[model samples]
Target: MKRSKRLILLPHCVLNQNAVVRDLAREPGSLSGLVRVCLEEGLGMIQLPCPEFTYLGAERPPMDREEYNAVAFRQHCRRLFAPVLEQVTEYLARGYRIVGLVGIAASPSCGLFTTHFRSGEGPGRGVFMEEVLAALEGEGLSLPSLDVPLGYGVDAEETTAFLARFRAFCGGHP
Candidate 1:
């Protein structure tokens, strides 16, 4: 019997972590190289979250949430992730069984384990990744997500190892 293809979902911030997009109409990134690697490793599917979620409004407000309304803050997050959620749903519908998910390590919007906040600085925490994972879990998707926290530095070897690990998890030969 033929083995079912595996899918991987990753935030687009993985391509460009430091840049923010003020214009929503602009196309976000060309993660072609990364995608190529995935294909080369025998990954059958790849899903990318909407750029807006990772870029459009990534920075935290100048002041703490105490200066912002809870309703507005929640609204901001929902709006930013709206497009991403839509794309994620679409990917899931395409018979893509999520094998792994990758997220930035410390982005207020896309980090998986650490994100900056307004208060005296919260410990390693990324709201975006947490939210996305929760949603995926709600839908019964099982996938391992790795959060690489290097703010602006890309260690090619480490990243390659990370991807290799994901491939191994998916039954791909190391």
Candidate 2:
């Protein structure tokens, strides 16, 4: 069997902007630029589940970390992410290099480096991301994770900057 050199864990919303709640989607459908970059780099990609979507669905109102950081929500995230962790571990065991994750900034669930809470955005980990990181730590695994802004359409220059950062994070070139 062929093995990929790297695996990229992406937030599901990156692949399906339409799945996001109202006024949250950035691109019309998918973040094609990022997707194309990943394909060009020959990186294997895994679209991680949207915890909010699984728990509340597409029509649910947007929430901040304060709203989604309940114990029940954390437990739900762990349960929802169990299979993903298993798959990542299996890939590692099979000699595939699991590179890192690309998360959405300001997301209450999947944000990697920055999250939204209490009507403000700040430097923090999202609930789902926290759970995933904990799981990875428990298994003695570490991977680089980067965050992109939430609304890709809000600013062209910001989007370009994000893409540049993402490319840099993916090993300096795309």
Give lDDT per model, in order. 0.54, 0.86
Model 2: residues with Cα > 4 Å off, grouped in runs: 1-3, 172-174
Model 2: per-residue Cα lDDT at residue 163: 80
TM-score per prediction, in order, is 0.59, 0.93
Q: Against the hidden true structure, what lDDT does model 1 obtain?
A: 0.54
Q: Stretches of candidate 1 above 4 Å error? A: 1-4, 15-33, 44-73, 79-95, 117-124, 151-153
Candidate 2's residue-wise lDDT over 52-148, tens digit each? 9989988999889999999999999999889999999999897888778888888888888889998689889999999999999999998998887
Q: What are the per-residue Cα lDDT tens digits for candidate 1 across 1-174?
A: 664555666666445433433432112454444555567766655445543433335653333223332555445655655566666577679765666777655455555665556654344545555556666676675567666545222566666676566557555677
Clash count for each candidate, listed in order shown:
2, 0
The total of clashing pairs for model 1 equals 2
